[model samples]
Target: MSAEGSRAAQIKPFVRQALVCPVDKGPLLDAGDELYNPRLRVAYRIDADGIAVMLADEARKVDEAEHQRLTA
Candidate 1:
């Protein structure tokens, strides 16, 4: 596996079932470099430096079209 992939795998256990969305207090899906909330249609980016930015303000609001595509 690639280095990025390995890092993501390693980080998965640390965040999975642990991290939650600050805005809605909902569960977050660990999508490699991004933590996504399908219920709220928001995505928080994981920095290349290994920092998980869980702040709502730092998250991107996914529009209806993208949300459907992502959740589907």
Candidate 2:
């Protein structure tokens, strides 16, 4: 990310509300700096611009314990 794009650390409320899992088309939870899809146990990183990295291939797989925490 460029320095200019790193200005925001939080996703805009409206943007967050509109975000969904690219794979499942399900709602995503704003888990700090990442968007988590608890149903699929995957997480997408938030860019420095506070935009979601919504690519399915780039999503990180959540372990069972981590999934528990994310959902909790």
Candidate 3:
């Protein structure tokens, strides 16, 4: 591959590494089951067992403090 292409590939991880949650400025965690947004108190689960579920609104508010610490 070209030098520019290799350089771009190397930078991809760094670019993705720089992304942090807007709410808490903390790292987002992949809980295997889902991607939990602690600040928003939401857990986005995809393809769980056999169903795709989105935890939002009141359901997402179940563990606000726990999620915050997880993200932090």
- The top-ranked prediction according to lDDT is 2
Task: Give me the runs in candidate 2 sitting further than 4 Å from their true place.
Answer: 1-9
Over 1-72, each residue of candidate 1 has an lDDT whose tens digit, in order, gives 453573344565656568789998988765556778998889888777767788888899889987776566
Q: TM-score-based ranking, best first?
A: 2, 1, 3
lDDT of 3 at 69: 64
Query: Tens-digit lDDT track for model 2 on 1-72?
Result: 442333223566677678899998999876767888999999899776666788999999999999888788
Ranking by lDDT: 2, 1, 3
For every candidate, C-alpha RMSD to the true structure in Å: 3.1, 5.2, 10.9
Per-candidate Cα lDDT values, in order, are 0.74, 0.78, 0.47
lDDT over C-alpha atoms for residue 48 of model 1 = 77
Number of colliding residue pairs in each model? 0, 0, 0
TM-scores for all predictions: 0.73, 0.82, 0.35
lDDT measured at residue 8 in model 1 versus the true structure, 0 to 100: 40
